[model samples]
Target: MFKNIKSTKTLVKKSLTIFLLAMTAVMFSSVAMSVQSLRGDSALDSKANKAGKHKIDTVEGGIERNFELQPPMIPHTIDKYRISLKGNGCMKCHSEKAYKKEKAPKVGDSHYVTRDGKTLKTISSRRYFCTQCHAPQTKDNPLVDNVYEGI
Candidate 1:
């Protein structure tokens, strides 16, 4: 009976170790895959050289003109935005205070409105998710050419 108990303990320990190792391997592989995807050569970067020397407008242009217009294309990729909430990274340059200092465009007024229709003087907790409305600009040419007359 003692021998059987000892063998059972050994089996449990082995099974636990195997499970732990398998989990660790899966975690590591997942991380590695993510890293590889991020690092893989971007076709866009290579094509950047082929792009015309036309000067494209940036968010700064919209600020200069006031937020009456859609801002220019963002120069950099915003793919890392999914990692955290507070660190949207856009707030680094486009926040209220940052806009004052950098003369960049301040976050829009609509961002201060709550879902319940209350207008907060500052960005409301509900509006903290930047990506819900805002999107990163890309260099790709538009697929359809249409006259979009604004109302």
Candidate 2:
């Protein structure tokens, strides 16, 4: 009967679909088991390397940037300085009013400009954190080979 034939055809189609799905799952699971990262079996949560023990260099002037538009490096150590929401010790010397007396470089003029393009009398709140852009230099060797020449 056509009804019997239709029922058998439907059953066979469903069986073939289930078989194909099972095969695809097996292939994907095998590929997943064999694949690995460059870090090997190390866990995602664990650190890949230890922290460097070298001290930051206190360059007399400043470190020359290898690339243009690089943020100027801090010439001195910042161990004694404190930067917090309430106060920034760096502004004591680097502020517009004190840079001349302190003989320290003035904070960049761009720091006075707000995100809205309006220039403010004081340093913009967005640029208040000095260490966010600038960092002290270290005399330690590079982790990888350096072939870069100054631009």
Candidate 3:
């Protein structure tokens, strides 16, 4: 009975050792195969191997025919400007009352005109959003050569 118990213990220990060794071998083999596959043959390398000659050019904005040509782009940073139905940063300068004090050019009269050609005494609610027409002037190089001629 003693001999049988000892043999059983030995068998269990040997089985556990074999299971652990098999798992370790599987993990190492998978890692080695992935490393071999990734060596010097990635998709990024294939994309960078392309050969081409590219040309760059300067591009300008469209011609301005309107007298109030969008205020020559917002001269100052508008990050702090408030834009809401109740308040707008543009009104501080362009409004009838504020324009005189701020010395900023008032919004164009045409903006107050309705689609039916009726001009309102004040800025129309639909045209109150200043950024809708005015954009910040950025100093960045053009991405492509534009041959567009505006009317």
List per-prediction Cα lDDT, in the order shown: 0.62, 0.84, 0.67
Question: lDDT tens digits, residues 1-151, model 3?
Answer: 9999999999999999999999999989876555523123446546443333332222244234345343445555577788897788778878888888987678878778888888888878777887887666445434334676544
Who is ahead in lDDT, 1 or 2? 2
Worst lDDT 10-window in candidate 1: 57-66
* Per-residue lDDT over 1-151 for candidate 1, one digit per residue giving the tens place of the 0 to 100 score: 9999999999999999999999999989876555423224356456333333333334433322224565433544565545265465767666777888866578877678899988887677766766665555544445444576644
Q: How many clashes would you count in candidate 2?
A: 0
Clash counts per candidate, in order, are 0, 0, 0
TM per candidate: 0.42, 0.63, 0.48
Best-first order by TM-score = 2, 3, 1
- In Å, residue 52's CA in model 1 sits off its true spot by 16
Q: Rank the candidates by lDDT, best first.
A: 2, 3, 1
lDDT of 2 by residue, 26-55 (tens): 989977677654454567799655443668
Of candidates 2 and 1, the better by TM-score = 2
Flag regions of model 2 displaced more than 4 Å. 1-52
lDDT of 1 at 89: 71
- Choose the strongest candidate by lDDT: 2
